[model samples]
Target: MLDREPYADLPDLPRFDLTSEDVTDGGPLARAQLSGIMGAGGDDVSPQLSWSGAPEGTKSYVVTVFDPDAPTPSGFWHWCLSNIPAGVTSLERGAASDPPAGAVRHRNDGGTDEYIGAAPPPGHGTHRYIVCVTAVDVEELEVGPDDSPATVNFQLFFHGLGRALLTGTHEEQ
Candidate 1:
């Protein structure tokens, strides 16, 4: 069986937190003032991200947004990206969809290589978007650029050095 804990063999790395000015509790997303929406403003509004305390020997980073409570058995991927340089610490809003220089955007669950903002079913209550930034040991994985999110995650199993997670909630009326 595949190891469920990919990081089980790696040494413990420092942890970091991700926060945003455009995210808040029970407020209008527009007022949180983040960029990018599924059908709005080019759909490239990446969230602002900042982090600290990456582990030693980290060569690069990968960012992803996952929703475990989606109506599918495999959940959903809102965004997936890899090959972010270690020197970079933040991404402008919509940057996840329109990655910066040298980064690669993987296909989300919708089968498109972009960020699809939360639009949970009318009665699904609230859904959480788990945004994660993984510190990696390599600049790039063995997987190809056209790989799906599952493929990219498979590669991450071996090279992940550490990770940081941030969560935001959304609900549709």
Candidate 2:
């Protein structure tokens, strides 16, 4: 397994709260959190996530879930959601499976809008799911719904006013 940097350089910003009912920081993902491709009875679902304490200038938010240890140099993005209203601080489980009105869903590495639950190759060792919620200074970023997650990631470095992170891990035997 390769160890890769999770994110690029980000400006110093206020720390915020990011909690999950289905995932714990630095813990293994539940079977339910695994992709349906992993086994029976599983569906690709995003876990319930809640956040708070956005900076004063924040007008919107962006959420990204990435796997840095993937067998690739650029890593892999499982989910990318942009143009979220600042007032919205919580996402129900499976909410990301179908984005709500006004929310922009960018194409992840797998070329999907919905979350693709972790599926580290068998015996690839532990893979980290780094979930991030970024508070942005603008209500909407320049990136569009058809844009790639990497494009949104680039904009985040410039517009993000604050951010919070919650990481979970998964590995197949």
Candidate 3:
């Protein structure tokens, strides 16, 4: 495993509010977001997300779904969406299956523009999915569709005005 900074240790500005009617923080993830692994039936749908209370100077938003407990040195990114209009504050469930207009879908850790959903390797234990909505200072991140999650994170880190997270957990049966 690779050594990396714990997410909480990162520099963060003031907090905002992010919520989801489909996902409960610290609660089980909805099956719709589960992956079809080990014969488990799943749709790999992104959960409905909503946010509010961004600080002044917010220009756009970035939304992502990351798995911190995956059996990986760098964790895993299930979603990496950039250039969401600042006027936009919510994403309907399954939106990842078909990205909304003006939403720039960046390459996730899975190397695709689609949400791969939760699919921990067998015996990998429970995993926490941290879904984040970042308020960015720029209306559009200077990035391409091929940009990796790490690249996007770097950009957001510096340009981020504030952020909010709606976390949920899941484990294989």
Candidate 4:
């Protein structure tokens, strides 16, 4: 596996506290977070996430799950939920199927607007799934269900006030 830090090139912004009940930084993801759709033999469920201490002026939030170690040039995006109201700080497991009102679930690299879970190719080594919660300055990100994860990130580059990250790793034999 290539040793790379995905966010190394991102603009340094204020950081907030992020926690997850079903995932942890530097830890292996549970089977529930593995991709059933991709034949990973696990339940495809979004992890429970919570965050706090967003910077002032934050009006909304964006949650994304990305894997920088995928065998693709641009990596892979497993989930991207945007335009969440700032008042909402936590999501229960499987929230991808029942996002908060006004939040838009953007299509991931898999062409689906929901969490796809992790399914690194067998023998590709461990992959890091980075879960990020970004505090935005607007109530809505102006992106729709048709927008791709890259598009949502483009908007976030301009409007993000702070961010929090939690990572989980997975590997196939």
Give all candidates' CA lDDT scores. Answer: 0.69, 0.85, 0.82, 0.93
Pick by lDDT: which candidate is best?
4
lDDT per residue as tens, model 2, 1-173: 77765654567778899999988999988766778854523577888999988889999999988989888888888889999988899999987876656789887787778888888888889999999999999988998979988889789888989989999998888
Model 4 weakest lDDT span, ten residues long: 1-10
Model 3 scores worst on lDDT over the 10 consecutive residues at 1-10
**Global fold similarity of model 4 (TM-score):** 0.97
Task: In angstroms, give how far residue 49 of model 3 lies from its true place.
Answer: 0.4
TM-score of 3: 0.92
The lDDT, on a scale of 0 to 1, for candidate 1 is: 0.69
lDDT tens digits, residue span 29-144, model 4: 99999999998888889999999999999999999999999988889999999999999999999999999998999888877888998999999999999999999999998899
Model 1 weakest lDDT span, ten residues long? 1-10
- Candidate 1 lDDT, tens digit per residue, 96-132? 6567788888888766787776655667766666677
- Candidate 1 — which residues are off by over 4 angstroms? 1-14, 24-44
- Residue-pair clashes per prediction, in order, are 8, 0, 0, 0
lDDT of 4: 0.93
Clashing residue pairs in candidate 3, if any? none
